[model samples]
Each structure stands twice: as C-alpha cells, then as structure tokens.
Target chain A: MNRLFLSAIFALSFFFMQPAAMAADIEINTPAISAIKNSMQARHNQLAPHYTSGAVGLTRDGLIAVRDAKAVPLKDRQSVNTLVAAENKDRNALYKEIAVANQNPQWESDIRNTFAQRWVEKAKAGWWYQTASGWVQK
Target chain B: MKQHLPATLLALSLASILSACVTINIYFPAAAAEKAADRLIDEVWQVKERTDTPEPAATESETK
Candidate 1:
C-alpha cells in the first residue's frame, strides 16, 4: 500500500511538473553587438577572396567593449590593439583551414581583400579594428 | 535494482533539465521596419499641396 502510494505521488509529480519545466525562455537580441556582427559579416563577404573565413578573434577587452561602449577605458586601447593582432592571426589561420575544408581552388587573396574593405565600411564608430593602414576606429 | 530506482529518477531529472531549453521570441520592429518607416516618412515629408497619388500596395521584399 505504501509503495503504491509513493509511486502514485511520484508519477503525479513527474507528469504535473514536466510541461512547465520544458517550456522555452530564450531571447536573442543585442542591437549594438548585432550592428558590429553585421559589419563583420559584410567584411567577411567582401574579403572572401583573401581568406576563406574573415573572423578575427576578439581579445578580452575587445570582446567586452564590443557591446558595452562605456566599458572601453583609455588604457585598454593598447590591449585592444593586441587583441586585433591576435584576432587577425586567428583569422588568417581560420581562413586557411576553411579553404582546406572547402577545397576552394582560386582567388583567395582577392576575396579576402574585398571582405576586408566591407569590414572597414561597416565597422561601428568606436570599435577597435586593424586594417592594412594600421589599427583604427571600427 | 534498489539503487537503480534512484539512478533512474536522477537520469529522468537530468533529461528533463537538459530538454528544458526555453526560448521566448518577442518581436519588435526590426531594422527593415524602421527603414520602411523612414522611406514612408521621406516620401510624405514634402508638402507639395494636396494633389498626390494614392498609397500603393506595400512590396513583399520591403516587408521582409
């Protein structure tokens, strides 16, 4: 009788609680970052010939400053530059890997350059970025 | 099997937790919507008397 009662309670709890717990509550929106991400994608497409992928990795401060504009301190600009350099290196490596993965046969440099130009055009005013002209505003 | 009861319950609990990724989508006016508004305002912003063409049907591409 006790075992039966326990089983009934357990079954009720599982059934009653399951649906509420399974509901989704995810929201995906960050306008400022989105603006930057769009700029980056445009940059990637423009630079497609130079690299198979144009994803320059972000540094610690670079990542934080992307969304929270107020977070960038004056002293962190050097860190941001370092981040840009690191990100560029990663992007270079990533492109090579992507090309290898996709087996793209030609015009890698041209595509990558186009992507870089697009990146330059779309960058937000204050984001740290590196260009052939050297590090400058996004 | 005595220990298995607890293990089975734990597995079920874990599965429930894993499966419960709740995503809520709240749609606000997107960029396209803002652009459309801008275009509409621009077209109508000029005051050239009251003899203008009637509003045309919105394009599918514009909404998207």
Candidate 2:
C-alpha cells in the first residue's frame, strides 16, 4: 500500500512538472523556425539595397515597410512592396513559431518585442528604423 | 473510519499538488528570448561582426 501511494505521488508530480520544464526553454526551435529563417535570409539580399536607400525601414513592431515610396523607382515600387509584405509575413511567422515552439503561444507579443529591439540594435548606420517619436536613421 | 484515512490523505495531497500546478505562472524568460532573437536576427541579416552589448536585465514580466 505504501509503495503504491509513493508511486502515485511520483507520477502525479512528473505529469504536473512537464509544462514548467518545457516553459523554461525560450530558445527552443523547430523545423518550421528553421524554414522561416532560411526564407528570410534568402530575401535579405533583395531587400538590402532598399534598406540602404532609405526606401525600406524596419518598423517598431518587428516588420519592414516602404518608408519612402518615392525613393524606389516607379517600376520597382510594386516589387519592393511585395518584398516588404513577404518579409513581414516571414517575420510574423518567425515570432509565432518561436512562441509556439516554446509551448507558449501567448508569449508571441513578448517575442515580437524582443525581436523588434534586436532588429533596431543590429541595424547598420544610415538605415531607417522606427522609434516612439517617429522614423529615424540608425 | 481507520480504513478511510489513507484515501483521504491521498486526496488531500493530490488536491494541493494540482492546485499548485494551476497557480504556476511561468514568466517570460527575457534574457533567453533576447538571445534567441539575436541568433535569428544574425542569421537573417547575415551579420559577420557581432559586437554585442548586453542590455539591462529585463524584469520578470508575466506574459500570460
């Protein structure tokens, strides 16, 4: 009887501890995250020139945008818009993937904010990024 | 009454353990999250020079 009681308690504790143990890891990655990162990296080359030209800027919400539509040539503007849209979609997926990978979908906003700060921090000089006041060059 | 004691004790302990689980508020691990973000950003941007400066330790903010 005593053995059975101890076994029951141990099993219950293990079951309850699983989520806490899983939640401790915020850097967990899945195949989905890797695929999203690869897609974004491949598109970065296409977006780099626009970032330098002040046409595309990093938003405060962890997204890219066409800050100056006129900076892009009229013919290329549509393509730039498409690129921005694609980048944003990938970025959104990246954040959600990270959160879901960690088994905490509710943490998506926190993950996004962390990435937003990181993007601005890593941005090169003369690159445009957003701040609370407005868009500024980094 | 004597035979019921073991079952009662088991139920009480189980209730406390289950309640503990319900109240467990896992906070956002900000430092770990920041590190993960940096890793992904570096890859996406293909950054070579990583002169990283640690930011202020983020408070244990509840994300739930």
Candidate 3:
C-alpha cells in the first residue's frame, strides 16, 4: 500500500511540473534577448554624443532642424543629410535588436510597450509624443 | 609570427563562437517622424524665446 501511494504521488508531481518546465522555455530565450538589447542601447549611446554635438548638425528630432538651428554656412546640406541617414539606420537597428532578444512574440510586444512608455517619459519639453488622445502636448 | 599562429587561430575560433549569438531587430526610421518633433520643438522654443510678463497691472491702469 505504501509503495502504491508513493507511485501515485510521483506521478502527480510529474504531471504538475510538466507545464512549469515547458513554460520556462519562454524565459530561456530572454537572457539572450536582453544581451542584444544592451548592446544595441550601447551602440545608440555611443552615437548620441556625436549626434548631439554639431558634428554634422543633427538635432534630437533629426538633421534639418539642426542644420537650421546650429550649422554654419561651411557645413553643407549634404552633411546634414548624411548624418540623418546614419541616425535612421542606427535607430532601426536598435528596434531590431530589441525584437530579436527572445523567440517568443509576446516578449517582443512587452519590450515595445516598455520602450514606448520610456520614450514618453524621457521626451524633452515641446517634444511631441503619442497619446491616447492623439498628438496633444507632451 | 610563427609562434603565435595557434593563438590567432584560437582567437578566431572564439570570435566565431561569440559572433554566432546575438538577437536584435532594427526599429523604424525615426527620421520619418522627426518633422513632427521639430514642429513641437519649434513651438516650445518660441515660447521660451518670448520671455514677457503678463503685465496685468499695466493693463488695469490703462483701463482705469
């Protein structure tokens, strides 16, 4: 009777643990994803100073505004255009890196939502961010 | 150079192993949306540039 009871308990525990074990795979890809995100964020941070400085006259918004606001006559339109193009590339790569962090699609959505909120919070004065009520003030 | 051939090969192998792993998707180009951001920034800049007081008392005196 004791042996039968032990057998039943073992089977019950195994059944209960299976779902948890499978669920953990969703997390298995997450560490890899996090690593990618860190690297991409680092890349953006690395470029941000040059973008912020008048190197090619790229504003936070992008090139044209920086051209009008900061650049001297010596800095040609082509320079601003080139910087804008590079910034676009890096920004696009940033999102791709974040998305690839995990195999699970849900993790991608979660990461997107998280960054969307962070972008809003970090926006400077007069920096218009999206809102539920349309493009109202930041 | 002859003495370090094994070290270079080992370094290349390790680099390949590391390079095989990384996941990240690029984002949509933010430049497309930058125009809107600039419009807003311009508005804010204009507000800051015009540092005037309300001048309510002056208006009241003129009214009197």
Candidate 4:
C-alpha cells in the first residue's frame, strides 16, 4: 500500500534524525562527567566566598584568576593564591575530561567557550567576570 | 509515464534525506552548548537566588 510505504519512510527518517538532535547538546550524566562535576562542586565552597568578596574572578578563557590580590588580607594572600591555582587546575582537567568523554577531544575549545559564556551569564550580580573587552561585574 | 513518476518521487525523497544529513553535519549547535554549560554551571554554583535587581555598579577598585 502507498500508505504503508510512506509510513515506513517517515519512521526511517525519524530514526536518523534523533541522533543529530541529541548530538547538539553535550551529555551531562555519564560516569566520567559526573566524576568531574563532583570535583568541581566540592571546590565551589572554597571559591564562593572569594567570588563574593572580590578576591578572585572568572577569566575569559574559562578559568579562575586572582582579580585583586589586595582584596584578600596579606596574611591570607598566599592561601588565596594556592586556592586559585588548585581551582584552575581542576577546571582545566574538567573541561579536558568532558571533551575526552565525549570521544571528541577536538571539541575541547568549543566546550571551553561554552563554559566561559555560561560562567559569565551565571555569575552573581556582584561577582566579576572577564569579557573580550575587559572584566565586568555581573 | 508511471515509471518516470516513481523515479521522480524516489529522487525527491533521496534529496530530502541527503539535505537532512548535511544540516546535521554543518550545524554549529551554539544554543545547545550554551544550555549544557548553564546546567553544569548552575549545579556547581548552587545558584539559590536570582540577582537581577538594579544596584549601583561595583566600583573599579572593588573589581580590580
């Protein structure tokens, strides 16, 4: 029947379309992704207060940086530096891990750009983030 | 004429299928990536409240 033939064609088209739709978004819950996410969440506590106090800020390249070394007291400056270093290390690893997990390590730059934009968008009103022009508070 | 009609339909369907495949390959997927990034950032930031209220801009010294 013509109806049956058309229906079969429709079904086949749908099957091929599904993956292309899903591939647009990054996968969030694979074991490797969840592991990296957990590490980042644990680090957030250490980073949060600094974000609030203007001691550290998000960089345009999707990493954390010490925005104002003087904002932190001299006594705690070394500690803040250490924290920033550790957080940036973890963030670099997280982006690399996500790209690797997706089986397209080439996506690393795209993934980083996505994160860079999201970090700026999701930043609290008082927190600082970098833009192509310069740093802005969001 | 009937045979030619079937061949035309088949060619049209094949063309549609090929176009769909090409779109999938060429799509930049900016919006999807943004959405994915937002989900992860929200979870890590534990965003609790919306901060859209009007406020004085932060001083240059504070953001330095």
Candidate 5:
C-alpha cells in the first residue's frame, strides 16, 4: 500500500513538472526561425571585417551601427552604410519572424531585447558593443 | 476512511498542478529567451570553433 501511494505521488509530481518545463524553454527551431538564422549567418561574413576594424559596432537595441564612419575608406563609406542598413532591416525582420513563429507577435519586443543581451554577451574580444553607459570594447 | 484518503490526495494534487500551470504561463520567460538567442548567435558568429588566424586582406574588387 505504501509503495502504491509513493508511486502515485511521483506520477502526479511528474505530470505537474512537465508543463512548467515546457513553459520555461523558448523554441527557436521553427521553419521561419531557421530561414532567418541562415540569412543572418550569411550576413555575418560581410559584417565581420567592419566589426574587426571598429567601423561598426553592435547597438544596445539589437542592431548594428556604423560607429566610426572614417574607419572605412571615403570611397567605401557608401557601401558600408548600405551594409549596415541591410543588416538592421534583416535583424528587425528576424525578431518579428521569431515572434510570429511562436504564434505571439506581441512577443517581438521581448525577443529583440533578448537578442540585444545575447549579442553583447557573445561579442568577441576587441569588438565594440554598446552598453548602458556607452560603447565599450569587448 | 481508507477509501477517502486516495480521493483527497488526488484532489489536492490536481489543484496544485493547475495552479502551477497558471503561474508558469504568465511570465515572459526572459532567461530562456536570452539563452535561445545566445545559442543562435554563437552559431552565426562561429564563436567556439574559430581558429586564431588573420583575416584576408581586402581585395580591390571587394573595395570597389
């Protein structure tokens, strides 16, 4: 009788734990998310040089910004501007896509904030990133 | 008395489980979302598997 009671309690606890675990895990492997990730990955190569040269930096708002316009040659400035614009556009779209994939478009801002923190956290040494105070080299 | 014990325990467990579900659903889950974002960012940046080597010089074509 005691064994049966213990087993029943264990099962009930497991049942209750399942939903909590699911609620805590954020899903990022949906088809829409995968496509966005691929696009971002492709763009990273283009952006890598600028990041290394300190011409561009990751912004606090989950976007990239051209930190020092003069870092690029005068002739290449326009191209750098174009690249930054395209990257920001794609990033905004990606956040929106992830929220939509989760069936909660209202979560877009939350998703963006999450990405903002993650980007800074994952930044390489010598890369510039914006913080609450100002730009800092990571 | 013995028959009522199982029913009472079941009822209490069900009530607790429902409350837990409600609580879990309400929060924004900021930590989990950040973790997921970091995972994807790491993959894009190739952070872990990168070799320490100088990048190629900018070719004339790339600048143009």
Candidate 6:
C-alpha cells in the first residue's frame, strides 16, 4: 500500500510538471544571444540609410530584402545586397539563439514569427515593410 | 490500515483538485515572445523610446 501510494504521488508530480516543462520563456538571454544582438546593432548603422531610401524593407518572415533597387544608386546596389544578406543572417541567428537559450530549439519558428511582427511594429514612419498582400510603406 | 485509509483518501482528493486546475497549453507563450522580440528590436534598431508603447514589465518572470 505504501509503495502504491508513493508511486501515485510520483505520477501526480510528473503530470503537474510536464506542462510547465514544455512552456518556454521567450525573453531568456544568454551569451550567444548577447553576441548576436550586438552584431545586429552594429550592422544597423550601415542599413539605416537604405531603410530610409526604401531600398530595403523588413520581410514578412523576419528577414530584410531589397524592396526597390532603384531607390539605391547603381554603385551602392551591390553593397546594399550584401548588407541585406548579412542582416538576414544575423536575424536568423538571433531567432535560433533565443530558442536555444530557452532550451527549446523547436521554438525558433515562433520566435521568428514574433520578431517579424515586432520588426514591422517598431519600424519608423517612413520605412517600408511587407504585408501578406504585398509590400507596404510604414 | 484505517489510519492509512484517511491519508490515501485525502491525497487522492488533493490530486483530483489539482488535476482540474491543470490547463496544459503545450504551446509557447506568445505574449512573452512578443515582448522579448520587441526588447531585442529596440536594442538592435536603437530606436528612441516611444511614449505610445508600453514598457515591458521587467518584473514579469517566464510564463509557466
């Protein structure tokens, strides 16, 4: 009887903990996350002008793309592409880093989705960002 | 056996009560995620603080 009761108690405890274990803390940070954010911040300076000129826009999937190449001078177009690619690489890393920091790498998509909306939400007044139908100026 | 009977019954009742309160949402907490994403965005973009946006609660721990 005592063994049965103990087993029952253990089972109940496990059941209660299972859900809590599955839920992730999205804001958790670590050294990897800090490094990724720092890199992104530094790159933002280079990307800021392109954002203003409408050469690039935040994508619906949390990445950046050259929305209007004509907005940039012909000489700077290649550099703009390089900047956009680098920014996207960092963005992807940031999402993965946050998920790994949370100890649940599977949360990467959700994290990226959250960032997609946030990047649009925090975009400056004159900036451009993507919508489901098409690109829209913010 | 009699003494153990009451304890067992009490434990069972408590377990059932807790089970009722258990809402297992296996999905990630979206609100917390949005707040986190906003925090990162503000840091990376170095945007000036907007009065219209509410400050993320610093005291709020991970939603469990």
Best by TM-score: 5
* Candidates ranked, most accurate by lDDT first: 2, 5, 6, 4, 3, 1
What candidate 5 gets wrong by more than 4 Å, as runs, is A1-22, B1-6, B51-64
lDDT of each: 0.37, 0.85, 0.40, 0.78, 0.83, 0.81
lDDT of 6 by residue, A40-97 (tens): 8999978987887798998999999999999999999999999888888888888998
Clashes of 2: 0
Measured by DockQ, the strongest candidate is 5
- Give the winner by lDDT: 2
Task: Specify the poorest-scoring 10-residue window by lDDT in model 3 chain B.
Answer: B20-29
DockQ of each: 0.03, 0.28, 0.01, 0.36, 0.46, 0.32
- Alpha-carbon TM-score of each model against the true structure: 0.26, 0.72, 0.32, 0.76, 0.79, 0.74
lDDT comparing candidate 2 with the true structure = 0.85
Q: Which window of ten consecutive residues has the lowest lDDT sum in model 5 chain A?
A: A1-10
TM-score of chain A of each: 0.33, 0.84, 0.39, 0.81, 0.80, 0.84
Interface RMSD, every prediction, one decimal place: 14.4, 4.1, 17.7, 2.9, 3.7, 3.7
Write down the TM-score for model 1: 0.26
Flag the better candidate by lDDT, 5 or 6: 5
Q: State iRMS for model 2.
A: 4.1
Please provide, for model 3 over A3-54, each residue's C-alpha lDDT reduced to its tens digit, 9 standing for 90 to 100.
5654565565455555434333223134544454444344443333333343
lDDT tens per residue, model 1, A50-133: 121123322222121132323445665455445545445544443333223223313234234433443444333443456445
Q: Which of the CAPRI classes, incorrect, acceptable, medium or high, describes model 2?
A: acceptable
B1-64: candidate 1 lDDT, tens digit per residue: 6856865676577556434422111222233223322332232222133244343466466655
Error of 3 at B6 (Å): 64
Writing each residue's lDDT as its tens digit, candidate 4 over A103-135 gives 567778888888887898888879999878877
Residue-wise C-alpha lDDT for candidate 2, range B1-64, written one tens digit per residue: 8976887788788878766664453678787788888888888888964454333388568788
